[model samples]
Target: MNRKRSRGKNPWRCSHRYPLRRRRRATPGRSRGDPAVDPEDPEQDPDDGNAPPSDDDEDDDEAGPVVTTTHRRFDYPPPVPRMPRETLEMLHYDQFWITYVGTRYRHPALPDDWDMTVEISIPDEFGSRQNIHVRHAPTRRNSHEAAISDAAREALTTLCHAHREDMAITSRRYYPCRSVERLDAWIANPEAEQNPRLESTIEYLATLNTDYNAALDELDMVRYENRKLRAWVAHGVEPAEEEPVEDPADAPRRKKARYNDPEARTYIRHHED
Candidate 1:
């Protein structure tokens, strides 16, 4: 017997006649979790800056940059005060003393190539006087003058080292030596035979150096005031009134002398027969 079909509604619907919607597949380079895009979408462009990020880009954003922090400490030394150019130039050369003992002995057969020794006095880089001893094995062309010249040259080279600025010589004094014997004797007994002229020069240079450093400190104070004034103007505030400077005489005084009388000869020279 043939079964009769229901006329009100079909019990089983054909899948081809009413198909359910299926999810779209991702393209080859598309990442998971990214919204599926329609190839036919007019806004979608593979080469556009707005293109979806790949798997690597997403992973990088999830993992933030790896930073390395280091802590270090450094210690710096205080700055050295620079000497003015004029000062260096004026102090570059100094007086030297050379004594040929053989000349006083009336030795006519003294060889020109005899050993030579000289005393060199010049201002050091710090503007302090320094006395140096120089000895040279004389050649056939070397004389007393040549020996003195060589010593002076070496002393001058030391004074002008690392100098590239300008400074003026406020004052300089040159004293003539009357007698070497007297000088040597004075060296032996400074209390009895003091060189007043040289002592005065040393005192003057010490005073000058002290004055220069004090002037620098004053300049720093002035600059600090200027900076404060500028900051006050920027902030639209009235600056505080400065106190009157005290008289220099009223300031506390301390005798800070850097001068120590240097010996004429640091060590005695011994001659061998």
Candidate 2:
């Protein structure tokens, strides 16, 4: 009975060995007689093949040159007008007052009202001396304003007088010719040419070289003497007899230099003897 048994087939084994096939992808417009595309082709377009490329897809060319623009307007305010030459000279002299007296008297909080005065003197080559007075007004408010104001007014009046005197000195140094003919004659004179230093001095005086004069006059008598001494030394000239140098050995030696000794004087006398 076993030999005659019919061959039996395993349906589960056959189904496991042969799995179900996947469905093929459908091509667009293929059914309407359009050409079908090969899915694996490199030149294929994804979107109906008619749309233009987007910015992200476009290739970048070389970078363009940079351009710049500029404006020429001024950034600061205009400069203030400068005072006239005469006014400037006056101001310069007045500035001295501000420097010396004003700084000393000016209030710490508000220094606008600080009264100041400065006197300046200058001597020319011709042995004439000129005096200049300078004054400044107080720009601040204080308890002593009235007194300061009175003093400032007086100083200003004195300054005016001094200025006039300075002008006179300048004028006297270089007297203007009465006529052009006279000026020409003076210029043509051989003596004038020969004395160039005097001519130059006169020219400087006529121009009222206030700054130069002031600078030269800044030296006091002591400074002048010192300068003269230095010049003489440079030229190998000896100083006058009035100026003396003490010999080291001859200088008086100290004798009983006690501060509070009652007999210090007597002791000193005995030491000298």
Can you give the TM-score per candidate against the true fold?
A: 0.20, 0.16
> What digit string (tens of lDDT, one per residue) describes model 2 on residues 1-273?
444222342211111111112222344544311212222366874333222222233222111111111111111121111111232254454321111122122211222222222223334467543333333232212323332332233243333333433533332212221111111101111233468887565555433422322222332234336534643544434323222324321112112122233322111011100
Per-residue C-alpha lDDT of model 1 across residues 61-80, encoded as one tens digit per residue: 11111111111101111111
Candidate 1 is scored at a TM of 0.20
- Give me the candidate number with maximum lDDT: 1
lDDT of 1: 0.28
All-Cα superposition RMSD per candidate: 39.1, 45.6
* Candidate 2 residue spans exceeding 4 A from truth: 1-100, 104-113, 123-156, 162-273
Q: RMSD (Cα, Å) of candidate 2?
A: 45.6
Cα deviation in Å at residue 13, candidate 2?
A: 99
Predicted structure 2: lDDT:
0.27
Q: Rate the local accuracy (lDDT) of all candidates.
A: 0.28, 0.27
